[model samples]
Target: MTKAERALETRERILKAACEVIADIGFENVSMRKVAEHAGVSKALLHYHFDTREKLFAEAMTHSFAQTGTDLDGGDADVPAGVLLARIVRTMLPTDEELRQDWKLWQELWVRAQRDDAARHLAVDLYDQLHAWVGGAVERGVASGEFAPCDVAAISTLILALCDGLGIRVMLADPRVDLSTAQSTIWSAIAPSLGISPAFPET
Candidate 1:
């Protein structure tokens, strides 16, 4: 591999490891040594990539938030309104290991942001981006007649807030609750407004 490629790979590995560590222990307790250990690299090497613990965490978290929001733009690309709304709804649940990490890390970041200006700014920015994206999907869906003529902004916020609350319930229960149940509940709650019935047959 080229030198640049190796550097990029190492950087990504460090960021990925930092994301998991922050989720596990949080920003206050997170240490450079711990991150290095988690990444399977020496402390010196970790420092070579990120001179300080704060830089390492901020960069990793920025990367994490990007994944959650950047795609939300949907780039004026023409997707079916219903499909877009469904996509927005689906991003909320944690269906895999990495997303689970992102979910936990987001909570940790929220608390850390309370006292740290930089973290706080990042946190608020991410939230606004997510809200706008979801709100846009709802608006488009309503305009396309995919949903009833209702208040899209309010409903989108309601849906986002519900997902947040449900996420907390899932984390507290943590694997004991089947995710399908939460997914179905969210779908059911919005289906009527979306002008569709739940896909599952009612007993």
Candidate 2:
């Protein structure tokens, strides 16, 4: 491959390694050297790509989210909006191993954001992206007449907050709150507002 391609590959490797390291251990315990070792690159090369641990952490967290492939637009037009929204809600939870790891990274960011200004900003920016995606789905549902006209922004915030609360329980292996229960609870709470059934869509 060309030099640029190689560089891009290395950068991606480092970011993936960073995500794994930070998720395995707490972010506070991770070092650039540790990430470099995990990525099978020299410390100098890691530094060349990301000058600081904070920068690396930010990018790693963003990378982890992007890996989910959750998009804001252009799903199967034939799919009902409720089904599409249900799919998006399911994706936000730690239903599988990869999502579990991604959730761990999010937990790390939550802890770091409490004290680190940069991390705080990153958290807000990431939330904004999530909000846009969820809100867009809600708007689409309304426009398609599959959902009742309501406050889209408020509904989006409520859905996200519910997911955050229930997702933590699922991640912690709370027997009372399995993935299905969490999903159903969210659907039940919001379905009335959207004029849809409380049942979680099979999709």
Candidate 3:
């Protein structure tokens, strides 16, 4: 690979390793040395890319969030907006191993945010990004006349809150709350507001 490509790859490896280390342990326990070792890179290289633990944590969290969903925006244009929305919702849940790891990292962030100002800001920023992502789909559906014109912001916030609540239950292995049930519950609550069927769209 070219020098730029190699550099990018190394950065990605370090960030991913940081996510796994932080999730496996907690933010308070994560160190630059630990992350460098996990990434199979030298400590100097890790420091070169991320000068501080805070910076590493921030980038790692952002990287983890970016990997949560499929590229819905690049998906088939012919798919209904509702289906795309469903797919987005599904991505937020701990439905697979990678997503489950992402959820664990989120859990770590939530705990850290309770006491750390920087973590709290990062948490809010990440949530804002998530809100915009969900809101974009809702706005598109309304513009296409596929969904009822309602408060897009309110609907998006509700969807994200519902997902967070149900996702925690699924991650905890709550006997009554499986992935399918959590999905149905969300769809049942918001479908009416969007003028879509309560049945979860097959995504």
Candidate 4:
């Protein structure tokens, strides 16, 4: 591999290991040495890339969430707004490996956010991104006459709140709720605003 490619690969490897370690233990207990050991790299090399555990934590949080399909702007540019909103819902489900990891990382972040200002700021920023993406989809749908007009800001925040609550339940493995139920509940709750059934419209 070229030097640049090799460097990127090493960084990804480290981040992956960091995610594993943080998911296994909370952020407060994660150490750079533990991450290095998990990555199977020399301490010096790990330090060369990430000088502190905080930096690694932040990057790992970004990496984990990225795997959750946060980029709603890409793919199937011609997709309808309702369809894109459903896609976002489906993506948030923790039914798969990457999403499961993302959910776990979110749990860790929540605990850390209570005690760490940086974690709190990061959580707020990430939620703002989600809100913006959902709001954009709502606005598009309204403009296209595919959805009824409503308060975009309130609706977006509601979607985020519902997702966060359901996601946490899923991550906790609550006996009362499964993926399908939580997902359906979210769509059902938001359906009145979107002018559609709770079930995802057949694509």
| Candidate closest to the true structure, highest lDDT | 3
> lDDT of candidate 2 vs native?
0.92
Candidate 1 stretches greater than 4 Å from native: 68-79, 174-178, 198-203
Clashing pairs in 3: none
Greater TM-score among 3 and 4 belongs to 3
TM-score of 2: 0.96
Superposed model 4: Cα runs more than 4 Å off: 70-74
Instruction: Report RMSD for candidate 2.
Output: 1.4
User: Which of 1 and 3 is the better model by TM-score?
Assistant: 3
RMSD of each: 3.9, 1.4, 1.3, 1.9
lDDT of 4: 0.85
Q: lDDT tens string, model 4, 1-203?
A: 99999889999999999999888887778888999999989889999999988889989998877767655647766788888888787677787877787787888888888999998999999888888878998898899988899899999999888888888888778988788888889889999987877786533
lDDT of each: 0.76, 0.92, 0.92, 0.85
- Overlapping backbone residue pairs in candidate 3 total 0
TM-score of 4: 0.91
Model 4 is weakest, by summed lDDT over 10 consecutive residues, at 68-77
Measured against the true structure, the TM-scores of the candidates, in listed sequence, are 0.78, 0.96, 0.95, 0.91
* Tens digits of lDDT, candidate 3, 1-203: 99999999999999999999988888889889999999999999999999999889889999998877758757678778998899999899999988898998999889889998999999999999999999999998999999999899999999999999999999999999999999999999998899999999888
lDDT of 1 by residue, 1-203 (tens): 99999988988888989998888888789899999899898899899999987778779888887776345436765776666666666567665676778888888877878888988988778777878888887788677776678877677777788778776777677664556666677778877776776652221
Model 4, total clashes: 0
